[model samples]
Target: MSAWPDSSSIPASETAVANKSEGKSTDEKPSKGNREQIQVNPKVFNGETQIEVDGITVDLRNRYLAALLAWLVPGAGHFYQGRHTKGTLFVISVLSIWMLGFALGGFHVVYASWYPGDKRWHYVLQAGVGSAALPALVQGNRMRLATDERGRTRSDYEPLWNGFMAPPHRPVLESEADEVAAWYARRGSGYEMGTWYTMIAGLLNFLVVYDAFGGPLAVPISGRKKRKSDSSASSSDTGEASAFADAV
Candidate 1:
């Protein structure tokens, strides 16, 4: 056996083993900067926490108020969100449609009179346009006050429905009731058409309200299509090259 080496002169095998162990410890131990970097929340990488519009920061955390405002007045929510052009367009178009219907059939067209024999579903649709359609409720109340318990018009309010109802004429023959029925049918047709126009306007405004609350529709990305075209071109080129080689 050789004399034992001094502590300073350790065996080459032991020295190599010590060096390898030291290298592993240095490599495996993370630096302070890297440790801090890895501690970040993963959700932070997903998307933005706030949206900036027209130099104003909007916290998208609560949009219920905007939706309510939109319901109260068409395009108002868009205006609140800084979308002036869309809001103005929606207000103009929706109001114009509503006004046109009102002009066609007069105040009688918008009344929200819903009784057992007078259930008007069109009024429900018209109410979606907001305050512009609320006058109908007042008109309805007046009509209600002018009617008797039997649903017949009071003598005082008879003139009010003159344009809407058949003319008051004494029947000389048994067939006179048919003539009155025909007259009512003609008036009913016109009122139905006007109600349709106003209801459609309200429906359109309802869609606008949703748009205002949700913000503008997003433009679709075309990057994926471009990548697909590039890949297809590359594959075609490879196929052609192989074919040419075979031909050669």
Candidate 2:
């Protein structure tokens, strides 16, 4: 018998190492995995977009719906998001301005119409207060000439709901100057002031709506200044070149 071990008795692994064979490995290294052993807490995300402003945390939930809610009723989105402080403030500020404007203009400054001479272009801006301004559309439609079920045509400028938000009489039907004079005689400067006030409310609501859709501005009020001052102080302690040193 031969003194050396039989070739059939040698394991393939030892044989490959001994011969340095260029063969595929079998279970030499750990298997590749796509998962991590550690994970972040799921609560951190929780489907809400949160922003910090002035030490306050604002969680905006479903921002698109919040925006639409804010537009329909100023601050409603904030209310939905549980930001009561902001919601109350927005409701008070926006509605107050709108109400004051409506009162000043004899509650008739927000009518919608595209007629010449009294084009009512201001209504475009006023409509930013979504639901509040939508009534004008209804009133305008009511004021338009329509036939009854009896086949009798109603007169133009006819109004229902007590003419609330109805478009003013067609200025071109008579004279633009005459219509202006009539309004001036009725409410003097109140109409103009009210128009501007209501429009301002609408614009402000637009901003609130945006705030609902997107969190507050990311600009830090004091953080940047504080950091800059700290850096400057550190640099000074290190005797680094500064504007004064350059000047000298």
Q: Against the true structure, whose TM-score is highest?
A: 2
- For candidate 2, the per-residue lDDT at 47 reads 50
Candidate 1 TM-score versus the reference: 0.52
What lDDT tens digits, residue by residue, belong to model 1 across residues 1-248?
66886867887678768879777444477777655322222322344433422222333233566666777788777666655666678788888888787666543566666554456677889988888876667656666677677655566753334433222222213354543355345566665667788899999988977665544322212212124446556555665544432111
User: 147 in model 1: Cα distance from truth in Å?
Assistant: 3.7
What lDDT does each candidate get?
Answer: 0.58, 0.73
Candidate 2 lDDT tens digits, 1-248: 89999999999879778655656555466566632233332433455477543233456778889999999999999888877768889999999999999999888889987655567789999998889999899876664445354433355546767877877654334443554466667998999999999999999999999888876554443343224446546544444422212111
Candidate 2 yields a Cα-based lDDT of 0.73
Clashing pairs in 1: none
